[model samples]
Target: MQKVEVSDRDWKHLLDLRDKVHVPGSPAGSNSNPCMSLYRPLAERTKPFVLAQVGQSLDGRVATPSGDARNVSGSDGIVHLHRCRALMDAVIVGVGTIISDNPSLSVRKVKGPNPIRVVIDCNGEIPADAKFLNDDGESVILIQADDVDRTINGTQAVKLPRRQSGLDVEDILGALRKLGLNSILVEGGRRTIARFLDAGVVDRLHVAVAPLIIGSGPNGICLPPVHSLSEAQRPKIDVYNIGTDVLFDCDFRHQYQQT
Candidate 1:
């Protein structure tokens, strides 16, 4: 990958935002993360600049077994999520998110253009009357592994390769980038986030830690077991507080591509 220089002004803006949100209990104080040195300018690269967002409990649970996760991050976190969505070219999620939450996936709380809603549905399971497909002008994409003839009214079903784990992340990004989507925000329901992270295609990740702990629930990222701390992936992270929630901006590209 070609090295892209981050503009001084953009860097300053990010630093200002970081300083503005630094609170007593934020994780930005961590001095040991290896990914910090890789932070640089945000530029147009080979693929869309992808950022994954997750709002979970302190213990890292995103939702209960039954898929109920409303109000976990409070009002400020919701608005912040919307703001992130507004800044991206598209927002993606797995079919599980659509079935469980049936989220409209539009920009409501914030003032900005609504992103193209992309759903990774390898099995063609999303219902015809799903709420995500209800919007008329908004772009919605449903990706499947096979060339299934079934279709939803407003959803554009595209065929992509599927792996044992799920849909191929590389192919997904390539297709989206070809469509002129330069930036993508992945809003997830655990499995979808795990696939991207496991594939190592993720550039940035924003994890919002709410102030509560749900002892028994679905985790935010489900990875293979690692025996030691040294075996763990530690991206450079910047922490900020959005009301009662603490947001961790984890930069993965810098950690992985450092010379």
Candidate 2:
């Protein structure tokens, strides 16, 4: 990934809005700059927030069949993700993402504090040296099954009661809440984000669509089947351009189900 482009004056507002991202919600209106208009919802959070993001091709493929996803989002999408990480209190991923991408999960592209790193490893499957576990003075929480006695260095092992589907989404969120990580970003592989989306806990979803089209690859999202158009989710959407990618910011705040 490329370093943060500080010279993009159009999006320079992002560098300014990175830290001051949460205030009480206000009436909606469009701003002249798409950067400000697209990011307004994030700053208006009045309660705990959970959001997920995915970058894919126009054909909806996140990676080739061989699992080569490097540079799929291009430079701008990568920068946007780093900004999101800076704005959130914590960033989460599943064991699959750790094994596949080995992401550092830090706000390296922008100038801001790194969010606490979190991993949902139900049975302690991720290796100790995974990049996400690299100690940077910030907290790291490994959510595993209560029966799993294993622990990882550079992390606070927080085990919760597991359910049939690994661990219940509600249980995981509750555990994070007690740790004071309110603004959460579920930055992950498709399965993990789909699990959270299916649980109806995600407050927003960002789908950044790139221009490339890989005919055979893993899709950006795979959720439980919805029979028809009416049965599907119809979120309030705000569109914006981030370089060669088009971002569809889907607001699901009112759709979140309280536990």
Q: What is the lDDT of residue 221 in candidate 1?
A: 86
lDDT agreement of model 1 with the native: 0.73
* Whole-model Cα lDDT of every candidate shown, in order: 0.73, 0.79
The top-ranked prediction according to TM-score is: 2
TM-score of 1: 0.79
Model 1, 65-107: lDDT tens per residue?
A: 7767887786767876876676677899998888888888888
Name the weakest run of 10 consecutive residues (lDDT summed) in model 1. Answer: 33-42
Candidate 1 Cα RMSD after full superposition onto the native fold (Å) = 8.4
lDDT of 2 by residue, 1-259 (tens): 1112233542344434444543333222235446556664554445788889999999999999998989889788988888788777899999998898888888888766788998999998989888667756578899999999897776899999978878999899999999988888998789999999999999899998888989998997899998876677878777777776788888886443323
Pairs that clash in candidate 1: 6-41
**Residue 66 deviation, candidate 2, in Å?**
1.2
For candidate 2, the C-alpha RMSD (Å) to the true structure equals: 5.2
